[model samples]
Target: MSQHHAPRQYLNWLASLGLLLLLGLGVELLLQQYGLRQQQAEQQRLLAHANEVRAVLLGELNATLHLATGLASYIPARQGRIDTAELEPWLQGLFQQGRYIRNIGLAPDNRIDFLYPLSGNEAALGLYYPDLPKQWPTIQRIIASAQPRLDGPLQLVQGGRGLIYRVPVFLADQRYWGLISTVIDFDRLFAEVEAVARQRGLAIALLPLDAAQQLALTSTPDTELHLPVFLAGANWQLQARLLNPQPPLLRGLRLVGWGLALAVSALIGMALHSQQRKTSLLLALSQSQRDFLQAFELAPQGMALLDAQGRLLAVNQALCRLLQQSPTQLLQRSVMQLCVPAEREQLQVRLATLRFGHNDSWFLQLLDGQQQQIAVECSAAILGQLGSASEVRILHVQDMRERLRLQRLQSEFTASVSHELRTPLTAIAGALGLVNGGALGEVPAAMRELLQIAQANSQRLQELINDLLDMEKLLAGKMRFEAREQPLWSLLQEAVLHNQPYAAQHQVQLQLLGPPCQVAVTVDGQRLAQVLANLLSNAAKFSPPGSSVEVAAVVQGGHVRVSVRDQGPGIGENFRARIFSKFTQADASDCRQKGGTGLGLAISKELIERMHGRIGFDSVEGQGSTFWFELPISVTKPQDAST
Candidate 1:
């Protein structure tokens, strides 16, 4: 009955999870869409505000230009000279009509000859227009082109920022005269623009399109909208940024309403389903009890039921046959009486815990009446728990002889194969070495290259055999470790010196950077050296010519970490997952061109684990890699300095 209903119950739970996940995804997507709409509206509003600000600013400049135009006609036509007495009254009336226009001047021959509001602007009375280097180019252009022009927000000779507007003056005979200029106080002009920006919740900045120009006026804002302004034929940008803008509250409330509705609906449906499930479970329990009784009696493995006191209450036919006893006779014995004397006391203690819901399995030798024993794996579970009087437990036992025998056979096969290959591989390597070393008399240069290839491959084969043997010993728990306290600095120096010749062959240098003071760690010194050598060889193999491999030791957390860094093409994403597996390489062709048994990192991981250390690496695809391992600081007494 349980077997039939279990899948339906699991399917119901899976459907509930999927429904909740889909609802959550829908809510997230809907919220994202609403957020996008709000952003678009904010951007459009900012753009509109920028346009309005530009209009207000352009109006101010045009009004000043108009005043300059009206005054230009009243200037008496002459050769580069202006009459101050005649122009003073007219300029005074213009200034009185507006507060933003600071002063008006008529300059002839590039010299200010006439001025109004002269009390504060006395410094400009005799100032030459072209003398100021910053404005000289624009001033000359206005004179040459005979056009109305604008320049500044510049530091005036008097004080304060001034926007100078100039329109070229001409005699009635078309002779080139100087110019008429109006000075607009920029502070007054910007105040008007800022008033509107404050009311609209925005910040504004006026920037020149020309990077070399020095007019800098800015305001801090959250989001930016840039608008192009053509001021007096000069390009500028008016940037408007919104102030802190809040999302619409109605949308948030609607989202919350939808979420609550979904949760409420799910809860109501779950309540109804749970009521039905309870009824189904009750029916299933009764039917399941009957099915369990039948299976228990027919099971092929031995099964037993025991009371809380560990006395056998019942035994299956299988148990009876295995013990060569009748069920009635087995029921008379307790669990302790069925175990060997050495295992009986321990089994009794295990049974005490096993009666309280501990479900771990145990291996024991169960004795029969004739005093013979059978090795079996036993697992126990509490069937009923109401103290010793009412508590009952069941035990399942399986024989493990076949599984142990197979494991031993596999381990022996691996060891024998590795041993058989080592002798022939060593003889082949020695013969190739003798031929390549000119021991058989001077050989042709062509034959020398062939002998060298043979010698290298033979040597690689010998290394492969050695790695296989080491892996076998580790798996069989036969590898011995002699861990002792050794200074990490000395170990690093030895590794660098040993790998220096091999690094030179590949044109890679090995450099050591050690800590300021010696730090000691418990490790097998010879095995640690092997790990370092393997890393150095791999680093050199993948590195470009003339690159260097850096070895460093540093204290991290509570352990000392030694790292090897190489500037080489890094590990690829596809091969990184299994990089530490035995007989694995990033590229199989690399094994052919760069020659490796590919068991180096795997063996290194095993050796480090035996010494209670950890090994890992960090790599970026095109940059390089850093492989490191950390061993705990030694707690043992320091060794003699010489050793």
Candidate 2:
């Protein structure tokens, strides 16, 4: 009877194998369908976003063109000696209707005929702001083509932000009178793309003129993402990628759900007919075990099974390929042997933190068989195998050395370039400051104007250099903080006094308020002074003559808080988000009209943080802005403290 049942058992096992194969096929088919659907949905969403942005941009472009054409016709009506007093105010009103528009200017005859946030029609009536100064070729191109072009990832003449926008204008019988362009906050607009992507849990990046990995849209201080991303939507290439892992498994299960029902029904029918239920169940268990083994061996990542004591129990083929060594040589090695000698202890501690059932992922500079320090990311899980009494630890390691190397190189290059540029900038700025301050003696109006231009550009250059340097330091973790005991109130008073004359020159009232006592902080004196100076300078720049700038410092929550409030045209809500961003000015027209580089607030923020402090600001449009920062309380260092 036993011999007769053997073939029957074999037949039952084959049936189970057949069911497993069917299940596998169903899973694959379902996964494919799911992936296809996901791709289609993503594509549709991207297309929609692109269309929306395109529509908005087109509307803005058309609005400006209509306004410019209207303004240009007025110039001809007045026989080319246009009086902005009649037309500029109307254009300013047009600009105020759009939230994204920073400032709009109408330039005629290759000069700024009128530019705004009109104190009146005369605000920049005769002033040719460099950023808004007539882009003659651009105007000619528009006149020549009448077709709109996205002119930049260039700094906006208005707010000093890098931009890309639509330009269209009017012409008289093929003569380029002037052009109208809309300055879009390209970065912020890109964020809108990111926000949509984020809603769907995706990664997004905006490339510079079709070059991805140039700069990132995300706000992380110094992340260098080098991955290539292309968005088929928007006709604008994408520098962003989004990843979601949940769908693949969900799709597979959908397929498996269908197949499992059929297999189970078949199994029950066969059992009832042949009296082979026991044999079928055993075969099912074996097939399941075999499938698990296949998944393990063919894993995409390097997989290693190590004992509780850190000895490698087994290395999969993936692991062998990664380490560039055979499994035989790796068998007795400790998990720590894969890491750099200095980092082994940390890895061991992290590994020990893993309980019998848990795991975590972390990154490190690890050593491979070639003895190279390669950047690697490891994810580990503790598992229990039936043959082993102790739980085994499985780790998956992937090499990220290339990515790390690229980031490091960028950081180093940024630092080197900043330093190289600073020397000349320092000399130039000092010269300009001296000339502007009468250190170079009295000057004629023409000479003074020329010097002013040079001085302004120098300041812009300095700001850019400083921003680069600060970014580099932040990236390299070379940012140094100096904290020392100091009278906080006294420092605030000193800052106000130093800026007093400067404020008077701008006709802004400077006031200081603080108790005549010691409210000290442990912070860098020079850096603190810099923060205060920058705040005061910005206040002076924006404040109207006769308006007051309040400077106050107080002890709040065991920290020293200082603020500078300016009564001026308030910061617009649109520009507030990037108030601390480098190389960005508050308004498009203001950026080109005013001479200061846009790096001040960014530098101040970095400086304050390095001094164990934080900075912030508050503002409202047409009401002005208030800037402030906090530093830890001054403390007495004991003699035993290490240097």
Candidate 3:
């Protein structure tokens, strides 16, 4: 090879190495950011999972405490001896309901007097609570503090690790009356948490703070995360570790970087060989520019490049055709010059407000070469970084003429159809009512039922027409709401009373739960009553004979939750998605049997929403369903009304 060729080859090699090094550094930085983000995400996930487990454990513990506290309140304190034989039935039933409780013991004077479900806890029977040296301190604390205490994950007398919850019983005047100890199996309690950790490929350990190091239970792990577990006054540590740690994100990044570097090196070698043969680099540069121009011109959308000062830099063929102007005529002109005179100021204001790398859009009228105005949606985006001299902006224009025209046509059609149906529907309903009321003449006995049926059908048809009109008005934002602050209890009672006649027809009673309270909410009284009536009518219709429909008003945070609960065949999953949609029904056969326009819920939803409230339901296929709505509480407090 010639000396000149050798020097060029060496220079190419050095350039390729520098490019590879830069690529490596870039990949490393990206991988560092990715690793940091992954660590944060992992920590968040661990905390969420740990809290979930904590909640479950707390729920179980609270249930036992509730039962024990309730039982303690029931048992009377006596001077001599207390008979626990008669209490066995209740204790046994309570013990059966617990998920992890192995035994429940009632100790009077710190000595076990009664223990239920003694099969696996026989050794714990008739034992003195304070005699157990290992757990005596925890028990003594419960007695001294007169509060419930949690003990163990310790060695139980019956063998195996279990937690004991001790609730100190107290009588009148702070007299201590024995204690109730609910023993929960540690292994069973953590079964769900362990299973979840296993599924997530995490190693977990539970270490009691009071226990020796040798007693710690763990899944063999690598990198560990420690979280504190505090339950019922017992402090414990929950350690989550990775069983099979993953290689850092950097590993894959490095692999990709090396592969790209190799490809780039090969490309550099090829380019160098081409350079030696074809030494005119200027021709290659010109060819690349031509390729870019071809791509820009062939794009479907109009493209206009504007400098930072908003003067046009380049215009593509599409843009030139859109503007009906030649490249020579439009070159170096202000982009704002294309807009009509009235829109130029607005365009200048929008451009001034735009930040680099952000987009802004507005509607404007543009003038063609012939000076005719055309409607267009203009979206502008600033390109490149702030304070860069090379930075420019791009404008994308779309013609909105067709879309606006179609929207106008749709609105006109809906309004006209609704108006046309209203007059005829009112006439039909009035005529049917007159005929059914015998204003036309006395009807024969055989035709009476048929007349009644016709009247009902006509009423249903009228309801459908009304529903359609209301829906249209709601969608068009033409409906008016007169809202006021009213007594929530009064509203609930009125709705219940109104629905009583309907409920009686179905032999279903409407019972209101909870005492009357002084709670007020701002709402359109008539609209809210209508919503409640619709819900009640549904509940009564679906309930079986002698079944009671429960109406409740619960005070939730910032709102009052009103619900209508019915014991009926609950909603099917298939119908749930469109439950609030117009013409939706749980069963198509229901329209015939239950007699509805299938628009009650849809209309009710609209009415509630107009009053700024939310409507929803909870259902189990076989159990029952509860349809509810919540309205924001009124700022004013009202006087309590008697039930």
Candidate 4:
């Protein structure tokens, strides 16, 4: 060969080598970017799973903690006395409702005086806190602070690992009564959370922040995410990691990219390689679509996709089974067609609004294929851009039959239990009354004091049962009202007089401020009196010693507003919203300092509303509170005016 021709051929080979190197660099960068995206997606998935497990863990733990608070509340309400006959049923009811409790024990003077569900927990019945040197300091700290604390996932005397929630019971005068201990089944609670994590291919570890070493409930040595779980005044760290940390598809893509870069050195193979890459992309897209379809089909809840007009675009087997219809029958049909006629028009309007991006949820009745009405809760959400042809909405339907059934059963059970409790309580109160009154014979002074305490608690228990029955009836819409025009002034006077004794007991005085006005209201006299009594008693209970609760009535805008004002610590901003919620107190300490079942205000609200009145309150944290109610004035008849 000529020397110049050989040099030109070598130059061409050099140019081809440079081009191959450039292609290899570009492919490597793209592969790295893809791997980064995969890692990000995996991290997000791990975080979501960790959050779900944390929520479940907190929910169960908080629910269990409330049981301890409830039992502690009982002691203060009874003036630091425990009646085994009455306490047994109360504890039993609480135990039945709690999902993870192993046992509930009441310790008077730091010795276990009573334990519910005594079968497996007999060994722990008489255990004293002072005997357990390891736990005595914690108990002392809790009692000294007068707060509830969570302790342990430690070994129990009953031969299992459990968590202990200890609540200190204080009497009305700030005397230390004892402690209430609730043992929670640690294995049962963590088992549920772990099961949920496992389903998502996750491993979780729960570490207590206070521990000297990292002690995990479940071990995940290589954690990718850390979340804080604050429950029952204890700080815990939840660490989570994906079980399959490496992505096989990403590794394969890296190998394939390098191989393709090398093949690109040959110019003739470029077009063929491009065509093969497009085919592979299409196959990947198809597989993704199949995976989505599988997930949609297997979802447990009834789900459907609908167009802007609410016509069914697609549905899952769950929806088909829920409606008792075939896929062919449901497809392309308007969702409103399945709803009862009374609700169809309203539902259609809501659907139209939802299409404009106002997502909503509502409860409605649907007609099955067999023409039976089924109650369901429906939630809707928009999927795409508003006003676009591609826009669709997804509807999630949950059957409410089981929920409704459970509600009915709960109401029936509450009513039955209240009735059963009332009978025995009434007899106990009557017998104690006779003994304390010396009707049975002359009683010793010391014995009389005990009998009087017993009688007072029995009465308190009876009132609580009555409140429970009234609340149940109100919720069930079974309460009957006998509304009649009554003189408002007379009602106010009677309430003040009735609550006078209770106010005296608290060392607070009751007074009427405004002059009596001739006002008549349409109301059930019995119910109105109950409302007034509740208000007056609450005012007296919270007022400072020697302070006065003032009751006043004034006419405003054709309604008479009666208010009860008190000069006390008033209400805290955070607790104001839940003051009327059943079974809620400002704090666990409030239950001890101020004795109440937390049902008075709630019951009063229900009664006032049923009688066509509105109830509200105004308060400042350090100043005081004024609770008021307004009712429309009854129109006086000519005959009554003449009289």
Candidate 5:
């Protein structure tokens, strides 16, 4: 038994060794990552400095090239070729013109045919060939292609101090010809950069490619540049420059690196500590989520996510309860699919507003699993995506079936009342017509007056019935709306004329207010006229004898408001709220005296409402009531007014 225990001791030793190996591996990984990060940081710093100098280098080359190109337009009278004699004098005069145009020349037929520096000697004009291989290839290409070709220093012959730029010539006819070229002196070209850097206490030098190697182009007696240079061509070079290479002790990277290492070590220890406690925290969070999800699913209203296209993304139990559809079934289903076909178009159009990142909303009647219609109000809002393909949205849905059902029932009752009155109305009308025709001979004078009264009351009743029917039609969306722009004042006058007889009968003075402003509003003329007549007639009826009834129209803030006010006892505050309700007359007793069916106000309200106008009453008890409605005025100037 004592010998067998040796295996267990060996296993304990192996466990300790594994732990040590893991610790070593982690430290090595951290140090390796630290080194990698340092290298990356240094590279990034170098890149930043490089970018700053890039513009300066390219600008110098461009300036030299522009000076040479300026020669093309100088010889306007000549053909598509440069006059060497004139070009030499012209270029020599412009020697110190730009940053780097040190010399200018013309090359044609694969040879340096003209050098501005040697312009004075006619023998050297075309005879002294650069004969350099680099010059010939570009020269030939320029002649063949009829385009400008730039050549370089390419180790300037006989130790010249500049870069050369060559450009092809073309006359007014755009014909191709020989090349005009220039060489920019490097030392003077970059003198400004060096002066600025030195003035700012920065060590600076013009580094260039000399004999295919990076060398200082300027004569810097003592100062040195540690900045790196990049060569783009035999002569062109790019460099990254910085103010200071060695930062001060506090600013030095050695201390910063040590500080960062300590901070990282502390972070690692804290991270380990946090990791040890993560199990409990995660468990708590998971449990909380479980509780939240349970409550969310049990909410009374439907919940869903929608894309910008109104397609469903997600749903909850409440949605299932409302639509009687599972989350899986609802996924990818468009709002159109849930609503009736007729309603789908409207919903789709409204939802399209979400494309502008605005919230869209509509109430819709959807067919449930049993094919029964259920009303719901859905509001959608766009939550724009991270980038480009960014058109996602969210949807909030609430069941409105009960509210809509109540409204339908109310409409049905109104329709029923209108239908019920028709039979009595017909009988009364027929009897009154028979009496008017004198079928019943020799009636008393007072009796005749009574019969006339009866006939009038009966007609008033018929008009109310018709108004109720129209209201129901409009509510059911069975009414057609025709909108057009008509002359505002003319329409108002016509309405006044139509209701003038009624005003006379009521012994009321009706008048229109405001100037003849040429403002037109979009509306259904027939419907709006009917609305005006109803209001004016009511005002005339309510007015005291010899009192005035005002029917005024005004344009304000791009809206047309038409108001009818009666100079009679105004509506009491208590009755104002229900005055527009169907069959609810504020002055119930006055209904008999005024000979009204009480549906006029309510119907007028609905009519104006459908035309996107608003109706309201401002009243003060015992004084007067001003019944007003407003419609959007057409601000589109008449075609003839175009400027």
Candidate 6:
């Protein structure tokens, strides 16, 4: 028997070794994938940084070069004549505005004629362009092409390295005049670029495309992104890379993966060689039970284990504190004893169903140790095999008193504020109306216009307050509706007439279309009219001037569908989900331009739903939108209504 078991032990060892190899391979593959993703993300980030640096460099170069162009334009407007008194101040202004300009020079007939601030730049004065063999060809090219060119990060006669932006001037009759050269301090400009790169922990280089202009700036290796920079008829390449390319955390993760594989393999091998399989299994089960008990004890909500008979097997601390009872006093006690007598029978019936594998949740009132009732939401589920003698159930209870109390307080506050503001607003509106109507005597024309404006604003404010009150009443379950069978056509006609003046104010026409039919629906007439008015006014406001808004109705199966279509910019994809939310507008500027409190749609939706209907809309971004609502048709037909 010992010899036969030896081979079985060797097989188990071999299996453990194979498991280790598989786990190691999987971990290595996962690490490689993660490393590749990190490298790609880093490259993308570096590319963005390189583009930003290129834009800043180009912006600085263009701004400095614009001064040269401005001077060229100014010289020609003066008919190719440069006056010291007029030209000095202009050049001084340009120099002060341009932070990176070294100096400005005007070369007439291919010779340096005038220099701004001749203190340090006196050496550059009276120098002929033809005398400098290196720059003469570039200046000649600028004059022939009649275009601007940026050249040189070369040594300047005035001292430091500088770039020259040369703009050729011409007369009104297209005669060649001279060149306006603006010297830019190359070192100062690049200092700013370097500062930005250092802030992002990146190294950057700028390489000119022209090989003849061999001025290249570079840093370390490991190039990541190469972006093009175009300015003043010259192209250059910008390269960027991260300072610390590889992160240390990735290396640490690789080492951790290998160590975990080795540890797992050694544990399995030891377990196999022990020859006490039952002892090892028991140890694992004990550990799992301990973990579960620790989690149950620390849970925030009340939790408990109950036997098949509904007696408490074990209770966590949260449950003990919730009931104001100790574990010693609550052990083996029936959980139903904690509920009020009025609800105990119902609770028992629900708990009995848990054994049959039916999970349930319901609201209940529990009595604490002092016999005080507490409102709670309770749920139960079977914890073990169904119908087994040792089966247990888990119960979860959450207190709901605080949530209900806060809701009541919020509703009361909204009602109080809306009522208080409506009274004063009504009085102000009435006074303005009387004054504008000449009831207080003949008024000046200017004062009458001001009074009318005040009246309009007061009216808008009053409408907003009314919408708030209606919304509050609906949310509080206090809005009363008088439902009756009514013809939908008459309601639509009344809404059209009511909103005609509003549509005319926005210069949009309203058209009522569809085949004539006597479709009646059971709804509150007043509320239904309000919903129609909201859709009509909204469509009219958004429609372009002279565009038409169409109101139509159709019957489908057992419901009547009413639609309001408009020729207006449709809703955006991002804002469509929140279109009916409280105080939400597609754009904030729409509130001031379109004149709304942003609560119209929300109130309309609530009112329609309260009247037993559904409201929705369909829209394409640029075409337009159609708002529609459906209401169940009344059982009483039109002919029956006449009876």
- List the candidates ranked by lDDT, beginning with the highest: 4, 6, 1, 3, 5, 2
Distance (Å) between predicted and true CA of 634, model 3? 11
Q: Assess the local accuracy of residue 533 in candidate 3 as a C-alpha lDDT between 0 and 100.
A: 84
Pull out the clashing pairs in model 6. Answer: none
Q: How well does each candidate superpose onto the true structure, as a TM-score? A: 0.45, 0.41, 0.51, 0.52, 0.41, 0.48
Relative to the true structure, candidate 6 reaches a TM of: 0.48
What are the RMSDs of all candidates, in order? 23.5, 22.3, 11.4, 19.1, 23.3, 16.4
Q: After superposition, how far is residue 406 of candidate 4 from its true place, in Å?
A: 1.7
Off by over 4 Å in 1: 1-400, 442-450, 543-546, 567-581, 584-594, 618-624, 636-643
Using TM-score as the measure, name the better of candidate 3 and candidate 5.
Answer: 3
CA shift of 287, model 6, Å: 7.3
Off by over 4 Å in 3: 1-102, 106-114, 128-136, 143-149, 153-162, 167-180, 184-232, 236-455, 474-499, 506-595, 598-643
Query: If both were scored by lDDT, which would come out higher, candidate 1 or candidate 6?
Result: 6
For residues 203-223, write the lDDT of model 4, one tens digit per residue: 887776645323544333333
lDDT of 1 by residue, 138-220 (tens): 88898888888778777788798888888888877777677788888988888888888878887787766655332553333
Candidate 5 overall lDDT versus native:
0.69
Q: Please give, for residues 1-643, the per-residue lDDT of candidate 2 as tens digits.
A: 9999999999999998787787877656655787778766665554454444444444554554454344445544555455657666676776766454555555564455555554433443554434554444554555467565555556643345533333343444555555444454566655565566566545655453344333443322111222223221112434333344233334223545556776667678977867676778889979987996687678877888778888888777877887788888889888888788888898898888897767799997766688877778898888876356487788888777777888889878878888998998899889788988897688778888899888877877887777678667764667776667766666777788898897888998788864543566777777788778888988998888788899876668767678888888888778888988877787657436454667778888888777778989888777888899887765653232111
Best by lDDT: 4
Candidate lDDT scores, in order, read 0.81, 0.67, 0.78, 0.85, 0.69, 0.83
lDDT of 5 by residue, 1-643 (tens): 8677788778877886675555555555665687666655555554444445555556666666666677767644675456666666676667756645645666554355656566332443553333655556665665666656555444565354555555666667765555566666765656765664444444444444455344543321122323334432234344334454433223223343455566568889999989978987989978976895576567677777667777776677888878787788888888678878888888777777655557767777888777788878888777665233356666677888778788889889979988988998989898997897699886778798889888877887788788778878976888777998767778888888888888998788778776765777788989898889888988888889989888887777878788888987899878878988877776677435655767788888888998888999898888988999998878775322111
Q: What count of clashes does model 6 give?
A: 0
Which residue pairs of candidate 5 clash?
100-184, 105-181
Question: Model 6, 353-395: lDDT tens per residue?
Answer: 7745677999999988999998999999987832333778888
Q: Pick the candidate with the highest TM-score.
A: 4
